[model samples]
Target: MLGMPVTSFGWSVNLIVYLIEEFNIKSIAAAQITNIVNGCLSMLPVVAAILANSFFGNTPVISVSALISLLGIVLLTLISFFDNLRPRPCETGSILCNSPSKLQFGILCAALALVTTGSAGTRVTLASAGANQYEKRKDQGSFFNWYVLTVNIGAIISATAIVYTQDNVSWKLGFGLCAAANLISAIVFISGKRFYKHEKPMGSPFTSLLCVLVASMVKRKAVISSKEEDYHNRGIGKEAKPSVSMPSKSFRFLNRAALKTEGDKKPDVDSIKNIWSLCSVQEVEDCKSVLQLLPLSLAIIFVTTPIVTQSSFMVLQALVTDRGLGPHFKVPAASVQVISIISSCIFIIMNNWIVYPLYHKLTHKPLTPLQKVGIGHVFIVVSMAVSAVVEAKRLRTVENEDHMSVLWLFLPLVVVGIGEAFQSPANTDFFYGEFPESLRNTATSLISLVFGISFYLSTALIDLIQRTTKWLPDDINHGRVDNVYWVLVIVGVLNFGYFLACSWLYRYRNLQGDNEQDPKDIIT
Candidate 1:
């Protein structure tokens, strides 16, 4: 999983620069392409996870995705190598350059689409697969922490080393390296097949969920029974009789699906007749779990959208700022974002070893995932405020001088990195533990969905801000970019309130009591 990111990020991190410099695209157009690619990569994980959970399973999905990614990288390498594949370079100071031909543009989009789709497959499902390798919940939590750490490490290396190679060396050579890395990742992952604890694909849960919704709505007039005996059990083979004493009070309308009507079938091994009148208690519960989680997931989207917008804005800020690290060494504007990645890597380790352990020692109990997420929210708010302050200072300084030093942006990046350390792992652990057992892979994939939505939302926010206010003018020197960060601060605070309410109402389905028990040793 880590290896594939290195391969993918190599090209993806420097994509905006590649489009602007090599393809002769405008800055705004290049940024838009970056946003689209980022959104697709983040969003497609849910689709990939569903496929993994319902049909193919994680290892096959990840291996196949890696192969597809390699093909995309190979295509990208071809574009880099063949001058004919790109638009002609413009004269030194020309206001406009030749646009890419339709053929070139089509090929580029196809390559990007393939890479983004393949990336989505590996990103979330791999985390679920890793969690599956361990039986203990604590072990699973540890794996998730390391999972985030590896992601940050991969991102940092790609954002810095791979980006530098692309910018300074040959673009073909850089893309060639990405292809090689992806090939190696595929080989390494496949080689571990015999040792891996592969989860078999369960038939689509979405179908069952949809059935529950349809059945509940269709039989809304039916009287809901509180008796355990009234609900269909279908106690067959591994599916034991449900121990849920009664249906949950929340989403009371959905309880009607499990309510036995006159025509409702008993716990038969054969089949269920009326889809609208009959559903297993377990099925109804699974649907309820999703409904319960939806609000929490939706609330985080607002928090993340601002972060995504800030990331892109930060890169632009770096470009205009003085990026010199020393007398000779100058930081690439793209690479400056690695500050956040590096901080995330460092803080994830600290969060797992120091913060979590310290809290446990002090309280005689481990911090809950919701608590961790709340702490992350606080850090995110602080990060936004810092960003606003820094941007305001930068704006003031740049008015009198050529540029402000990029080093000033590090505080906000580091702050947000710390926030991510708390929130990201917490969100993953929460979803992985709280979601229905059958949908664990899909649960983990929700994190990616949050990010994906945030990226798309960020693009929309940017457009809206540009249209409404003078905060995001074409040039930063003329705009109050600080005001944009202030707006995000307000949004973060409001979203945090929504998160608190949802978190208070939610009951953990898998994390607390159920997961704390010790499992019997596997006979390996």
Candidate 2:
């Protein structure tokens, strides 16, 4: 996972600069393109997760995806190497620079699509795979913490070292290095194939979920019986038994699917029963589990929106800021985002080594996933508030000077990073733990879904801001960019409230059996 990000972030983190410099794209257009690509990168993971769960399993999916990523980066490296593959560099203050040719643009888009798809495919599946290696839920949770830490470490390197290389050194060399890293990752993953505990694909679990929904709809008029024997037991062994005594009372309408109807078989023999009129108890419960998780997942999208927006725009902000370290050294505009990555890495370690242990020691219990997610939501709100203040300060300082120091951007990013450290792993842990075991891969991919949706929403939000007001003009310095941060602060607060409500109402299903920690021990 770490090695894969070296290439993934290498290309993505500094993409705005690449578009501006190599493709001669405008800043706003570049930002919009980045958002769209980022959105696709995030959203595609769901498809990848499904593929992993239904057909190829985790290890194979990750290996193939990593290989595809390498090919994509190699294409990108070639693009950097050949001047004809991209437009000529735009002169400073030149608005009339040549756009990329159709072929150049097509190849660029294809490469990006491939890389994004590959990266997204591996990102979450690897988490599922890693967690699957451990039987204990606590060990799985620890693995998730370290998984995030490793990701941030890779991101730090990409945002700083790879970004710096792309900026100062030859773009070809930088992208070549990314391609090499991706190759190494693929090789390493392939080499470890023997050691991996492979989970066999159970055909398509989604089919059963859809079947349950369809069966419930078909049996809508049927009365739900309280008897345990009313539910169908389709298969032999443990799967045929009820995961719970009854379908959840929350979504009572869905209970009709499991109702023993006239045509339904007592022993569920090979006899023909209308497929849409009958479902096993487990199928109904699986659908309910997903239904329960959907709200929390949707709420998380808003929490991530501001952070995604911050990272994207922070690059543009750094471009106009005083990025100099000394007379001889200069910070790359994209490299400024590394502060958040580094901070996240630090906080992940602290949370694992200090925070969790200390909480356990004091309360005789560990922090629950929802508690961590709530804490994360709080930090994001605080981060947005800090961002608003810092942007206001930067604007004030910009009034007197051409640019303020880029270092000022670090505070809000660090706050956001710490918040992510709390929330991100916990979010994954919560979903993975609470979701039906059959949908484990999908559960792990939920974070990516949040990111994907949030980025697209952020793009729309930015477009809305630009269209409605002058807060985000082509040249942000002339507009009230601080107001943008303020808007995010408001959104963040409201979203945090929404998250609290969702977390409060949510009931854990599978987590109780895995972790010995009491549900009442949650900090929030």
Candidate 3:
């Protein structure tokens, strides 16, 4: 966990600087490219998880991905080593710059592709793999909290040490360290092979979902039936009676998918024969579970979009702001996120060790995942508001020909970290607990999935803002970045309300059975 993020962030956290200085790319263009890379890093985990849960098991997929990461980072190291691999340096403050050749650009793209793939794959699979080692819910929950801590710790090292080295030392040395970290992570994962409790591939639950949709549409006119014997149990063996969950009454139209007509007369014993026409009762319920999560998921997209957008923009804000720390050390612009990481780390530790335990004892009720997530929402709104206020102050300072300390960026970023502390692990626990066991790896990757969509949307939002308003430009000194933050403040506030509606309407699923309707609305 530690080595992977260290290596991943070691290169990526400083990517904007690398592109602008080394590749001679424009600043705004560089930020977009970085967003695209981060988007890929967020997106690919779903694919990896689907593969892990459907085809190959976790270990095999992860083992191969780690090697891919090592290979990719090594390739990046080589690019840094060879002058021919990059373009000539652009003159400082000059509009015109040397554009990278096709060869240089291609190698860089290939390297990033590999690194993003490796990083995303390793993160999701390793998370699922770690949690799988523990059978008890408490143990799994603890594993998740610690998993987040380790990832943040790794990021802290990359954001601080690696970023500082890249800024003051050399890119070659910084990238070399990243490659070495990847190698060490691979070695450690391989060495721990015998201890893991491996789960076999469950085949694609998504396929079953598809089958449910198609079968229901095909039989949309069929009369709904409540008979337990009428619904197919294809998930069970032909002889064994699978008496678990009958077709659910909610989304009663979908119940047609499991209801048997002439297609059930002599159902082939070999397989779910022509599963498009008939599905198991379990499959119907699984489809409903995913549907039930839609509103909550959509609400979080707003939550995630603002946070990610703010994060990307903060780097740009750092570039324009005075970054001095002590007399000797000026913090790297890319390292600005370290504040957020540290804040998150602190909150996660306190939440796990002190806050949660203390709250449970005092209130006689443990904190539910929904409550934790709500707390995160409150913090995110505050963070965005603070961000806009700080940016406005910085702009005024810059306009007056006075300097604003980089420390001013600290408040919003710190709130961001605290929000992450609550929302991230809480979301992990919620999805992992609620999603069907067959989709365990996929459940773990849903947070990554949210990030993926959020980053892509944020990229679009940035593009839209750049095109329509004089908010983000090649030189932020001339742009109204505070306006951009103001827009996000609106987004965060609106989304917080959306999330509240979703939480109030949502009822916690009874995971124990597919049929039982024990609805527990968001825990007060």
Please provide, for model 3 over 1-524, each residue's C-alpha lDDT reduced to its tens digit, 9 standing for 90 to 100: 68998998899888988898899888888888988899899889999999999999999889889999888888888998999999988777877888999999999999999988998888889899989988766667778999999999999999999999988998889999999999998998888888889988988879889989999999998988778888787646664434355876678888998888985555553566668888878778888888888788888888899888888888888988888878898989999999999999999999998999998889766677777898998899889889989999998998899878999999999998999999889888778877877888998998888888998899899899989988888888889888887888888888888888888877666422432323554534
Q: Candidate 1 vs candidate 2: which has greater TM-score?
A: 2
Cα RMSD, model 3: 2.5
- List, residue by residue over 210-305, the lDDT tens digit for candidate 1: 889988987899888767877765444555534464678888899888787776655454464566567777788889999888998998888888
- What is candidate 3's CA lDDT for residue 292? 84
Task: For each candidate in the order shown, give its overall lDDT on alpha carbons.
Answer: 0.83, 0.85, 0.86
lDDT of 2 at 49: 90
**Cα error, candidate 3, residue 487 (Å):** 1.0
* Model 3 stretches with alpha carbons more than 4 Å out: 236-243, 267-269, 272-274, 510-519
Task: Please give the RMSD to the true structure for each candidate, in Å.
Answer: 4.1, 1.7, 2.5
Top candidate by lDDT: 3
* Pairs of colliding residues, candidate 2: none
TM-score of each model, paired residue for residue:
0.95, 0.96, 0.95
Model 2: per-residue Cα lDDT over 325-394, one tens digit each: 8898999999888888888888888998899889889988667899998998899889888888878888
Q: What TM-score does candidate 2 get on C-alpha atoms? A: 0.96
User: Which residue pairs in candidate 3 have backbone atoms (N, alpha carbon, C) closer than 3 angstroms, thus clashing?
Assistant: none
